[model samples]
Each structure stands twice: as C-alpha cells, then as structure tokens.
Target: MKVKSATPVDIFSLTDQGDALAVRLQMLMPGASRHHRPKPFIEIAQSSFRSGHRCIFICSTGIVIRALAPVLRDKYRDPAVIVIDQSGNYVIPLLSGHEGGAVAFAHDIAQAISAQCVVTSAMDYSRPIYTIGMGCERGCPLAFLQPLFEQVCREMDAAVTDSAVTDSAVTYSGLASIDLKADEAGLLELSKSLNLELHLFSAIELRQVEHLLSEKSEIVFKEVGCYGVAEAAALCCATKLTGMPAELALPKQKNARATIAVARSYAP
Candidate 1:
C-alpha cells in the first residue's frame, strides 16, 4: 500500500537495563535513535513530540505520561508514545491506541523482547480485526480485484455472524501477499481503498504456517512452494505481527483471477 514507513524513533534510556533494551529494539525497528543520556528526559521527549517522531521511554509508565502530559494534544495528532519498564518485562502503549498505532507497535516491541504487551484499547479485544491474504495475476485490474475482495469479506462475515441479516461490512486491518507480489499494483490499490498496510511474506515463511490452514492444495504448493498462498500468507503475517498463533477466520476462496483468505489473531 506504499504507506509511509515507520517514523524515526527517539528512544530514551536512563539505565543499563534501558540501554540493553534499546539495542534489542533497534534490530526490530530500524532507524531508531537511542539516547543513552540525552539532556533532560523531559526535554528529549518534548523535542521528539515536536518533531513528530515516535517517543519510546524505557521507564515507568507513570513517569513518561507525567513528563509528556504538558505537551499532549489530541491522540490523532500526537505521535505514538510507548513505555517499557527498565526490567524489560512489560511493554505498554501509553497513548495513541489506533491513529498513531501505539498498540500494534507495542506488540511488535514486546514480541522482540519476549515481554507482555499491555494494551488498553477495548476494540483490540472486542471488535477483533483480521488480515486479508490475496494472490492474483500480474496486472489484474481494480474492477476485478476490488469486487472480488468485497465478495470474500461478505462471505466471511456471513459465516461468522450466521444470520440472514449479515449485511454489515467486515473490516480487515491489513492485506498480505507473497513476497513476489509485494509491489503488485492491484494489491496496492486494494490496500489504499481499505486504508490498510500490505504485509509481504516469503514463500518459506508462508510454508511455516501451512499446517495451520484449513485445507491445502497441491496445485498451489507446486506453484508457490507453499500449500496455499492466501491462507498461509494471512496466518503467517498475523502470527508474525502478534507473536501468537493465528487461525483462519475464513478459509481460502477464489475467483477467475484472484485467491483470498482471512486470518484473525488471538485476543491478547
């Protein structure tokens, strides 16, 4: 979907533990600027917020929130703020649960650190989101891809709700495809239309999740070296993103030009 890459992070660390955690996070989040002993903690944080960079504080949540509280604006405009304890045992999304993606970002950091992610967003548990995996021809037109995507979601929603009145639209957090199709224009447009990111996974990574799919196809395996692109991609990306196993909310389905599937993460 060509969404902007992650904002540069300004990580503030005050102790040996914090410094160690910062190094670990750098591997997962590139372009992160770690401040072992930046001027004053408050000054560093305020400057980061002013510059529109994500601020990661390796300290107590209360300390971070209190220090940044003066400059805090609405969540939509504020940069994401995350707090991790010095011991690195807990990761918390202190602000920007959705718009700034503090929740998901915290999960990513926790996964890398083997810590628990503390998310306060209720919808994260209640309204659960899924990823849509798709594989299509090289130059499939939007006309074919868009409608096919909608059709798959509708079918999934109906299955989940199990009601004739299932006319409500289903929401997906992101789109996924094989690494080869990472730059596919149709998938890019579909992600833009849905306002979500496109997650690309390699065939080997997709294969790792094949055992989780509802069914497998030898034809797909021969073609992609993965049992099923749609289901496998969906499951693999979800597991990677959440650091938890994911299940197919909807199994693979296809049209003349596109194959699709849906996978949902377990509630944290």
Candidate 2:
C-alpha cells in the first residue's frame, strides 16, 4: 500500500540551530507549524497532544519526555512523536511507535534530511529491514548511480507480490559498502540523495558472509580482498543492523561503472 501524506505536525525547537532544522523539516511536512523556544513548554506540549497533532521535537529526548509525561495517554490514543537532534544526525521515534505511525514517520523524515532513523520500538523488531550494498568505480558520477538505484528500486517494487507487503515495507533503511569505499564520491552522493546512512564494513567483515554470496569474483577479491562487494556488503550491513543473519533480497545487479545488491533481515 502507498504511504499516506504526513498529518499536521508541531515542531518544537529550543535553540537557533534546532529552530533552523525545525524550519527545514516544516517545509517538507505539510501543515506543519514551528514553535521556537515555546514558553510554558509543558502546557504547549499538552495542547498539541490534545489536538492530535504529530509532534517533532528538535531537542533533547529527556526534555521531550518530561514535558509530555503528564499528557501522555496510551500508544493507541497518543499522537506520533519524533525526536530529532539539532545536528540532524538522528531521527528517533520517541512515542506511539507503531499504532500512531511514529516509526514510519521517522523513516520518512530521516530520508528527507539525510539522517539516520534510530528505531528502537519492540513492534518494529518484527518488521523486515532492507539495506543496499554498492560497489562503484572510483570517482563514479552521481549521474550514473542515481538511475541505476532507481531502476533497482522499481524492480523491487514490481517483485513484491505478497498482499501483506506494502510499498513502505520495502523502503531501504541504509546503504552499505566495503570500508575502502567510504570516501567514494558517487556512493556518498547516492547515500545523501537517499537520506540514509552509508555503513562501511571492512573486507574481513564482508568475508564473514562469503558463504552466502550468490556469485563470487576473484578479480574483486584481488582488488578488495573480498569475493564480492555488492552482495556481501548488503548482507553484512543488514546482519549488523538486525543482529540476525540476512538473505539476499536482490542479488547483484550491475551496470558499467557500478554494482548494487539488496539484503533483507529481521530484528530478533
């Protein structure tokens, strides 16, 4: 199923940087209003809660928790709440994770701003997580990488025939590659475009998943010390994310300058 547009959002910020970030987020969220350094914060929070508005707090998680403590009802009745740090490095689903759609909203916000969604909800543990693994020629241009990435995503969308799986279910949670590619411009740009963290694994780390690779390449091994870059990195990252073994969701797909693969895993 297609994800719905976000509901009205109330963004709370305590500092100038947080306010700026809040404003940036506001532009992306329809019907979002900004509340910079809101006085009587608890009262404002309670009012926002009563209105059933989705809330984004660009401040300390502690402050948000304290302010909202008195007003919280239950997960089913509370509105979705997200906490984003001033630096925008992380987006967290702070309350009403599943029933209120905070987890999914966190992912959407993270993707919009190139931040990582740090989802810790127990209900989220049962969902599948996808990671994209990539290998590209040094200095490969974003022009080459973006289209291939989109094509792969489209293929994944077409392949999801299960009635229970929605389009949102296949949203990629992160990108992965050998540590050697950590500075690769194209890979970095693609990760920025997707607004997902690019997790780098060492060759030794990638080797741990060699047995699961769908194809092996001696040429790649000679260069990167791993049998495969795309597939192995994908699986390795997914495993790391979920603390469980990962399977190849899409085996390596390559064009002239880049190779990409997808891996899937479940959190225990």
Top candidate (lDDT)? 2
Model 2 poorest ten-residue lDDT run:
160-169
The 0-to-1 C-alpha lDDT of every candidate, in the order given, reads 0.74, 0.81
Per-residue lDDT for 1-268 in model 2, tens only?
Answer: 2222324679999999999998788776546789998888889987997777888999999998898898888875677899999999999999977556577667767767888999985556457788999999989998888988898898777555322234443689889999998889988988998999999999999998785576789999999999999998998888888886566777899999999998877675
TM-score for each of the candidates: 0.50, 0.53
RMSD of each: 15.6, 16.7
lDDT computed for candidate 2: 0.81
TM-score (C-alpha) between model 2 and the true structure: 0.53
The count of backbone overlaps in candidate 2 is 1
List pairs with backbone clashes in candidate 2. Answer: 114-195
Model 2 ranges off by over 4 Å: 1-125, 162-169
Which candidate should be chosen as best, given TM-score against the real structure? 2
Across 135-230, the per-residue lDDT of candidate 1 in tens digits comes to 888887777788888888777765445322124566677789999897788889988988888899988989876655657789877887888888
